[model samples]
Target: GRGQAPATGQAPPPEGNLRARLTSFVGREEDIRVIGDDLARARLVTLLGAGGAGKTRLSQEAAEAHARVGGGWPDGVWFVGLAPVDDAEDVAQAALAAVGARDTKLRGAAAEELRVLAELTSDSDPLHRLVEHCGRRRMLIVLDNCEHLVDAAARLAEELLARCPGVQVLATSREPLGVPGELLRPVEPLPPEPALQLFADRGAAARPGFRVEDDLPAATEICRRLDGLPLAIELAAARLRLLSPRQIADRLDDRFRLLTSGSRTVLPRQQTLRAVVDWSWDLLDEGERTVLRRLSVFAGGCALAAAEAVCADGRLDALDVDALLGSLVDKSLVVAAPGDLGADGMRYRLLETVAEYAAERLAEAGDDKEATERRHLTYYRELARTTEPRLRGRGQRAADRLLSTEHENLHTALRRALAAGEVGELLCLVHALSWYWQLHDLRAESRHWSGAVAALGPDPFA
Candidate 1:
């Protein structure tokens, strides 16, 4: 049942085994249409997103939709699951088995087909034989879970796209295969209405009499707190069998503990909130993990210089921060966006769930949480000190905008300083941020910060 070649004169299977789902597919009609359009043009299309963002489920739905639409991928849509297979060398073999597995059913030669399928290509190269087999068929091959063996998957996709004129590939991965002409579609979290609908749908399924309107606000807040991730919503909905929507929303700080009700039929990683992220966390190298762990200290996301100052050390140089951050982004562990500054505007952040996991990792690793926070404190203190002067000059608006961006970080640093009784640093931060705080009209917050500073017994610097 490993990599095997088709028997000569063995007829091709008329169609594929993209399994029909039992649950109602919700809130992704537009996404389905977009994927249809992308598949219409690109030979290789990868649906990229973090684990449990429902890429595989979405891909299956898209394939089924395409099959119904017809005229494209005429031979059929074949699903080759790469999740259970770990070795890069075995990907071709798994694919060979999947495409041929369907055919064995059609011929009604189950016993004979198994024998023939097992006999061929056990000695020869399975990949070369697979490409040859697919050479003539017009089909869409769904390559699911390629992130674990990305390079090999890319090679297989490249080979098929180059040699098989009629075959198209629709892949689902946490990252791209980097193959030429590979169309990438990033799967984002569901929006509010859709997220609520999904939560309510799954929640009612969990408890027959459950209604989101029973606790509308709490239901909406639950979706918001979970970042609208479909898997998280489903897991939370499963809690309805025991807890109320309000109770679930309140316990999200312990989401790893609370949201464990995933489907038994799915992969183990998909069976829990922590397990979903743990799968991604295991994929990172040491340097990437270290950076990610340190990054958890940040409240609002940081810019390049902030990350370098807070995250880098002797093991990982300041220069490695950008590359590692970019790598994390590529792997879907981090989210990056353009900020207020031009050219140097990319701000990097983790999802709330991811940041929580990284924090847990940081604690478990015992990697100087206070030191990281202190560096975070020092970085923003200097930023505020530098920007304070610029705020009165021609660069006033730009400086204010930058300072405004770090509002949460600045407040966090201020609170940490006050807690540490670092009165000297506390005073400097208060002074530095005082102007920007006033400009932003945070008088109540300003008064509270001033009062905290005044209550610090005596001014050592003075």
Candidate 2:
């Protein structure tokens, strides 16, 4: 009875229970161990990082390891990749289907076929039933790309954790799902050593006799220049099929330009590292894209206050700034970091690649770009103007923050304003940035701005 199967033609049970094992893994032993350890100790673990950071691969490794170790639960490991299914409700259905759960209420043949699962299985709650079927069985359920429906993921995780004691969930996302009992593992970029190793490995696979000895330094340089990001490194290595490692290193000097080629079969956006970023950019609404491009004026990071001041020219309300920043963070276009401000909570920055893409978008947008740049310059110029009077007061910090964030943008805007024959705006900009120049010991820049204004003839405001 234990080994026999019914009339439906399902095969008989195996002679011995054979656990699944991962056949190969590369460059992420430490990460795999960390996630595996967390899954062993906690009921839920979230692997959080930017896109293409190998969350899926790491989760697979951990699942395979759990299957091998034996004592956690005997049922087996189940992984459901949620990337294709966008709806939250469908996620549960997909998981149920993956675990052989069937519903019986349908009238159509297709529905009946699906319903056979529920009729055959003895468990009541589908999710709980799936877990119970794996009773005393250590099961790891992976929820990949949870960032899209974070709230839904959190609710589902809570339900599973509450009802299914034997099940462990390994979730991977761009951001954390903020669930209790969820251990967040932030995945950093691959380390330089393994990154180079990966490059050599892939390169050798593409071309024979691709040794590391001759190309080690150049390979290392490529990794460093690409910020040790795996996807970027892989894309670089793909070029080694045609170019030498040294030539690849040389091309990386203008990485934005050089990192154009990607896998031929993949989606255009996924083909190259630039395409990945461009895909994210394409997903932005016009308003968000505009705000993002305007934000590129800042070199460092920007405060909500500064963003509102510089980015809002009657286009976006000040109240919308926070929400916009949050959206950008969720989209991976902007990153949140600790800030020194007590009033506002955090500072936000763009990745270098994202910033460059935004800058290009701004330049292409023509008059809108110039107009937004004017607003940006005006805001910083006003900040500079206001700070001079309150150098000894609290305003100094605000001024300094603005100056630091908007310095490059301010410089670019000033040059553009002068070149556009907006002499009045140029004078205001020069006068406003004077205090910033003095405070930051930028005497040369201050002199330059002052000369530009002077050349514009006598200022009407003066």
Candidate 3:
């Protein structure tokens, strides 16, 4: 499950400090369509995506749309915001409060006090009250920011879905709850056209008469560079008051530094790209964090075997690599996609902003940067040498495709090998990849590596 929904949109209205946003909702037509269909069919639908991917906003849109269509959720849509609540035990109480289901007797009392009074005098648990209040009441429940309290939210959702047949849950989280009867919808960045439209809309609002047509190319470039992430694009557009769209596009090379401004009223974790990423980073255990940092060493992405060879060691040994990698993907810290790596394998990657954050973490780790780089260099070197043979004969095209997908990683590895003066590794990599370099017409890189090999003189053994 994604988690609980936030208090937004007209159906739920603003109550109990739940204020709607001033900015207009942007693209996500496909997301809204899929989630609406899921809600119609599945009882539990989770909107899963990265922290700033606009899961909550999409959920709000879905709920409002459902309300407008008279989908027969008689009790209406209830949104429970769990971002501010840290303790697992508080999750149920937060939901109850969101739905206005807390005991009426202690209405004006402090929340902690209300909890104590209810626990001491009443035999009913918050879950029981929620179940009783919502019994036979057809309604949709939205859980927002469930990543931190996933266990508690999952348990609550499981019970609610089981006991209340009339209740449906739509949650937004960085990952799913992995519960039975759950539908996971992966939300992605907007496409180029919608991204440009969203930027235009917000950019005009940010600076009166900011004509998107005048800077259409630069604005498109901005969206492309930001990978069409809603929050990132919004933050960049917010800068139009001070900087030109071209400046925004150019400065994106250092996104963390450039995309720093965010509305102070929002959560600090949501104020900037780095802050959103940090919220996810702070959730990882030591092994996951270590693997994430190490995997950032790869430029494009890595296959499972490549990841195991480069990232697994010490506490995160080869045996644990698969599970750890799976966990990262589940948590949305890493993305999994089908690739040309191999028939049986999938490629995994960090988004550019995420990879940048991991690189910062690696720089700060200071424990085994050298060792990790050496392993990465060694792994890719051996990989090239072993695969070079396959690049001949009938299998040539397949091998070429595989190497092309890994070209960025290969370049990064070779650069490190050269810098560290690993003569054996450098020579072997150059010899193995020369055909690929030539096949792709990378004349300059081919010449440079071949020249370096010749400068190293003949192999002593031959």
Worst 10-residue lDDT window, candidate 2? 1-10
Q: Which candidate should be chosen as best, given lDDT against the real structure?
A: 1
Best by TM-score: 1
Which structure is stronger by TM-score: 2 or 3? 3
Q: Model 3, residue 435: what's the lDDT?
A: 86
List per-prediction Cα lDDT, in the order shown.
0.87, 0.69, 0.82
- Each prediction's TM-score against the native? 0.94, 0.71, 0.89
- Tens-place lDDT per residue, model 3, 38-140, is 8878999998898788888888777766655555576677889889998998888888777654234346667865675455435357778777767787888
**Global CA lDDT of candidate 3, please?**
0.82
Cα deviation of 288, candidate 1, in Å:
0.9
Candidate 3 C-alpha error for residue 170, in Å: 0.3
Q: In model 3, which runs have C-alpha deviations exceeding 4 angstroms?
A: 1-21, 101-124, 452-462
Sorted by lDDT, highest first, which candidate order results? 1, 3, 2
lDDT of 1 by residue, 298-348 (tens): 987989999999998767778898789888999998888898788898898
